[model samples]
Target: MKLLFIALAFIGVAVRFAVFVSPIHEFASQRVEFSVPTNSWRRVSEGLFLYGIGVDPYLGDTFHETPFCLGLLSKLHRVNPLIIDILFPVADILAAILLYLFAQNFLEQKVVEEHKVKTSFKKESQILMLSFDCIRTVPKLVVLCYLCNPLTVGSCWAKTTTVFTNLLMAAMLLSASQGACRFYRYISLVFLALCTYQTFYYGLLFPALHLYFENFAGSKTHCRSRGDSVFGLLMDGLVFIGSFAIMLVVSSHIMGSWTFLRGVYGFLISAPDLTPNIGLYWYFFTEMFEQFRSFFIWVFLINICIYSIPVSVKLRHHPMFALFTLLPLITAFKPYPSYGDIGLYLSLFAVWRHLIPQMRQTLIVSVMLVLAATVFPVLWKLWLEVGSANANFIYAITLVLATSQVFFVTDVMLAHEKREWHLKHGVETVDKTGKRLELHLQ
Candidate 1:
């Protein structure tokens, strides 16, 4: 298994490097699907140029990255420009490896939990339990899915900063899964802080992470009371807040001011740059009336964040699944989303393979996604290069992508619920009287 992973990693790196050296990468970087105003490598290069000449890159509208990212990129460029190119593929490979590790640990814990709860499940449902062979194989398949995904490859070739964010998220998940280790919990919180520092909306992940810690604690030792669980949550929350505060203070010190607040988080919220991307925000805000802009901005921001509460509550027993569901929601509604964000969550679908049999919209959602990908570049060229199409052309595709994502998320959630019902009851849908029973998820 180790050898298989190493080989897969090698091939993944080779594929990314091949794309890097090819002419396709230049075009990939310019694609609207991969490069948004906030994450574009071209924008980053412009920011670095301005910074090198002792000018504030954030003063203008060209740069929207955090000071930490800017400083890190500047140092890497100084060491060797080649290192900058190499870092993208390495980041992607590392994220995949971290996800693989997370899946393994999660599945192990899942098996243990299932064993303990099997007595409560109907005898007929025993067959629905995960097989040892399935547990052993799923992690490798997850790694393969992530490493070979075209969106993941495109993001790496484009050199978007979302790759780094995905890496931090994967590390956070892996650390959070190892709930028995105090050090891993601290590491997880710190990574979560970094993710929030880089992208403000990622702060919503705090609830899911807190629940994961609580679930792990409860599983490891059943003696802990509700008071103990609440105390643990408080400590974790404080650690996360402290880590975030330190990042902000250090970032301010690095830039000699707090201008990045407006540049990074402010830009995300205000949607000031209307550069077309594969997100719903740019188009809607571009056409929004001036007086109503603030109202709708608040509405949209709330819409993006409000799902975390219910999703966390509903998936309390399955915090990892909660995290996975939230990722798609973030990607769908975020202000300046790119293909990297989509790829991140799509890769994680492998972690829930058990629910695949229960999903009903698989074929329809797959078609919508493929169609959106195929037409994005065509519409962009027709609008920009040929002048035959318009902004509506691009906006239409964004809607298609967003709708497909919504369908996919809801489908997965329903599948999870159905599977749980079957486990507690029986896989057979007929009643004792031999009449078909109806199961509905509200």
Candidate 2:
């Protein structure tokens, strides 16, 4: 499974490199190139080098005050932008693998802990250990979802937000799984910081979701209960203060002073005026609203349906899944489309833990349709803009199909796990009562 996963990831990387090395359209290249200094690491890399040489590469011949990651990366070596693009997908795959390992270990721990609580030295204990094996099922599914993801493949060739978002998300998951007290947590912060400049607005969502996850996971309660309020307080302070710092740094780097905050906020709240005669929020709300409505609605409904299953709902309070669903929803609501909900990809993987039988197929088809709906627009636009099918498109479709397929395969696996869990617990009889049908473990 690991080899197969790695092979698929390399295929994605190959497609990215192919596109980067090829002679593509100028406009297409412009769209795909990492040129924008604000969010483009490549550009930031160049600026860093220029700065090291005592040359100002600012927009208007002034010193820039953005985060230092790009400058640092740039100073290391002179690399092609295409190479940099390839690195994004590669990083995503590597991060995804790390996430898989962490999740697998975490789930094992959960199984043991839950088994201990639910089963004592009784006949049920035997069944509980058998059921514990089922928890091991989720990690493979999660990794495969990332490996075969269409959006991930598509992101490989372009300077899109998806790759960075996924990488940061993977970092978050890895950190969470390792326990928040580790040095990796701070390292995760550095990844979060890098993500901010990689895609600016979209990358910001990762850290935002991280905070939400920390809160949802009972970490906030644990901290507060222990009277260690400083960490949580400091974290919240950072969200507000860091956001302002981002805006201030960007303004200082580009526009000078904080005047750009208005435009930034305005753009976030409303759409940019494409035409001179066009009005404000009208274009944002009405037009783009219609465009994304079906996709957004489908995502919401499908998730709700998937969550309706008993086992699925059981995970509702799990910090990872909770943050996964909420982050995407919040980011999706912004007037500007954000890949921040790339976190949703994680939720999609997490939900595979549920063992609902009847709704399984429906959930699979629904998720595929939603993914297609979300990704097709870009696929079609790129197809039309360029002639003929390309490697990236192929990668994108394969990823979409693979991710969707995981939904099916995982549902079956989860159902099996549920049955095993029941068997171990000695829940032999199923009773339909006036209130509800309950399945007990011993």
Candidate 3:
């Protein structure tokens, strides 16, 4: 199994290297599904060029990456363009490896927790508990799913900066899984800060991380008191904020101004660029009335931000699951999402494979997603290259894709609830009176 995993990793690397050298990468980079204004390597190149010529990259609307990212890439490009070319594939494989480690650690922790509570569960629920073999197997499957996922591969091939974001997220998850260690806790928050700095939407993950560490602190100290929870939360929050502030200070020094904030985060919040992508933001805002744009913009932005609250509350005991669910929501609704965002969340589905049998809408959601992926490029070609279709065609598919993702998230959440219920109440579907009892998520 170890040898097979290594071989698969090599194949993943070889495939990415092959794609990087192929003409297909140019076309992949151009695809709206893979590249957006925020993450596009083309935009990164444009920004680097402007910086090299002693011009502010943020002077216009070209670049939307953080000053830190711009500075790092600029140095790498100066060293050798091939370094930049090679980094994406390396980052992608590293992300996969991190995810594998996270899965292993998290599953181990889960087994220990379940073992402690096994007596509370009905005897029938024992069948649903994770088998010893599963803990050993699922981590490799997680890496396999991530490395072999088409969206991940295409994102790497396109050389989008989302690759780095995914890598940081993976590192954050792996660190968070080891939250019992003080060093790991600090490292996790720093990685989270970096992710949030690059993409503003990721800041929402702070609540989930806080919950995770709070739970960990309670478990480790055997103290579930309110004061202890609050103290832990305060400490973690301070570390996250300090890390983020340090990045901002460094970015200001690097750029000699704070203009990158307006260029990077402002672009994300304002939805200023309407170049169509997989997200729901562009088309609606593009055709929106000029007068009502501000009102609806707040509405839309609030729509994305508000989910973190209820999802955190509902999944408080399962902070990792909350993180998993919120990621796809961000991908589906954020202002400038791409296939890479979709890829990140899809790969994470491997972590919850135990819930698959309980999920009801998986088939329909899978079909919708596959159908949307198949039609997205077709509609784009018809609308742009062939001129037979219009923006409606693309927007319609985006809506379908978004709806499918929502269904997918909800299905998983429901599956989790059902699994928990079955564990406590047994797997029987009949009531005391012998009538069938249905489980409804609402």
Sort by TM-score, top down from the best = 3, 1, 2
lDDT of 2 at 255: 32
RMSD of each: 1.8, 9.2, 1.3
* Residue range 241-277, candidate 3, lDDT tens digits: 9999999999999999989889988888888898989
Clashing pairs in 3: none
Q: Best candidate per TM-score, number?
A: 3
Q: Give residue 71's error in model 1 in angstroms.
A: 0.8
Best by lDDT: 3
Q: Judged by lDDT relative to the true structure, which candidate is superior, 1 or 3?
A: 3
Query: Tens digits of per-residue lDDT for model 1 on 354-428?
Result: 888889999999999999999999999999999999999999999999999999999999999888889997887
Each candidate: what lDDT?
A: 0.88, 0.47, 0.90
Residue 218, candidate 3: Cα error in Å is 1.4
TM-score of 1: 0.96
lDDT of 2 by residue, 1-442 (tens): 6687568656644654555566532333244212121233344455666656755455332222243433434534455544555566567667667767766766775566556555443364344342555556667667666555544544444444345556765775566566545355455555555445333443433434354345533543453443343565466446534754664586456433443343333333333322211012222234455678557545533542342233323443343444343333333333333222332354354534444442346666567747754554466456656655543563454346435544544444445445554645454534455353443321
| TM-score, one value per model | 0.96, 0.57, 0.98
Instruction: Give candidate 3's TM-score.
Output: 0.98
Off by over 4 Å in 2: 1-3, 20-83, 120-137, 180-256, 259-266, 273-317, 338-351, 355-442
- Ranked by TM-score, the better of candidates 1 and 2 is 1
